[model samples]
Target: MAIVLGLRVLGIDFDDEERIERIESAFPAVSFVRLNGWTIAELHLECFPEKAFHEATDLIHQLGAYGELEFVEVVPHLVNTSDIAKLTGVTRQAVNKWVTHPDLGFPAETDFVGGGHARQKIWSLYTVNEWLSEVMGIDLGLELPPMNLVKQVDGYLALEGDPLLDGAKDFHASGL
Candidate 1:
């Protein structure tokens, strides 16, 4: 179990089904939400979350329940621009500019972790994979090019190593 913090902080359990069962049985009057969808973004729920929902990401650590359900508290996933640089093998400044996509005149799809002065975009590890598959045509193993890695030299998105993490980043930063 971990404590989720945001507008409100709450304790979440993800070790096993015991916590889920306990919450469900005890809070029969409360709303219950199911983990569903290719990305499992928690579209439906029995009740509104007091804070951000916690997501136990499947980052190749477990294969059996890679897409299975686990209880998570709601919270924004913290990420640094450098992490984006590693995923795309580019300089942090270039990655930050890429996130903005000002030259392309396109907006990223995302919800800022903190609104107003503290606002910053929330990037999902899962969305990065989908963009490569659907837009870049990468494979399930996260292998091969176009999706794996892209290098922008002379202002062109070039093909690089296997889209190790799918040569892509989901958000081009903006107020959103």
Candidate 2:
């Protein structure tokens, strides 16, 4: 399984690429991906839970020394627009409209193609949930702590995709 820890480092300028580079340099093994202002470090696990735990602890300590690393969310996997539409019981076009329409307060896409090309938007579950609740006023019945509390405790919140989401990926594979 692949585990990703999204770290939102506090009190640092988001434009400080050098500082981020330094942290990445310190941990050569961890694969860090830059998102908005968050640093997502991915770890692929095969065996030995204890070893992985130790590695994570060591990395957290190193990161803590540099700045306050607030836990963003454990990325379950990436999901596209269709998957979201299916999950929310909405049409794909509606989802697209929601994303593109101004004043909708939709979360920014993780990736998207622009200018003549078809847009391939993607987002994490956490981002979607937060947007749904805060902006759309749709409660998903998920019992999650407030963002402030999660950040205060540096708690890692897992953003998991449901079976419907997994099946949607398969549908894409089968050219459905």
Candidate 3:
């Protein structure tokens, strides 16, 4: 099954409007969203779990052709209690009770945001899905790449800065 994956790419220059249009036209399957200004972007696309690393690498290379590719990593899907409820087709009360009851063995929240009444707990969608499948015997039909694989791919990509930098240097040297 093809699963949706978000590739977080940094240091891509999208100053050329024509280049942006060409990229979009060429890779219609990938949707790019600028997260913080023009340099950082999240590319959303669907691919089989086993092919995530290859797919991400190909994307980084393709985008590198347009501009510098500084970094690339798989962005995990995050969700709150309400999001969990919606994803699992359960009520908010049920999710709340599960979190409060340790015996249920719900995954711990990855982080907390805000404070007091506005506070919200965040959990990795991957962990939540795993818990739902193992403990609750529910399969939401969502296939996420394993965290270990994600980390491995991320580490390998991080270490590949030299090649990407070399490509950027060549691009600038050509005076195009």
**Candidate 1 regions with alpha-carbon error over 4 angstroms:** 1-70, 73-80, 103-109, 114-118, 132-176
Model 3 CA deviation exceeding 4 Å by range: 1-3, 10-19, 33-51, 69-72, 160-176
C-alpha TM-score for every candidate: 0.30, 0.38, 0.69
Ranking by lDDT: 3, 2, 1
Prediction RMSDs, each to the true structure: 18.4, 15.8, 7.3
CA error at residue 80 for candidate 3, angstroms? 1.0
lDDT of 3 by residue, 13-97 (tens): 5576675566678776555666535334444446566666566566767777665555556675688999889988899999999
lDDT of 2 by residue, 1-176 (tens): 33334444444455677865676677655556666545565443332443444444456556656545544454444567888787788899998888888988788777754446775778766788878778887777654333332232233222112434544543332323
In candidate 3, list every pair of residues with a backbone clash.
none
Candidate 1 lDDT, 1-176, residue by residue in tens: 22212111123323336654564454332223333211212222222232112111221112113323332323223344565566656688875675676663323545556678977665654455555356545444532222111111101111111245233312111101
Cα miss at 159, model 2 (Å)? 22
Candidate 1's TM-score reads 0.30
- Strongest candidate by lDDT: 3
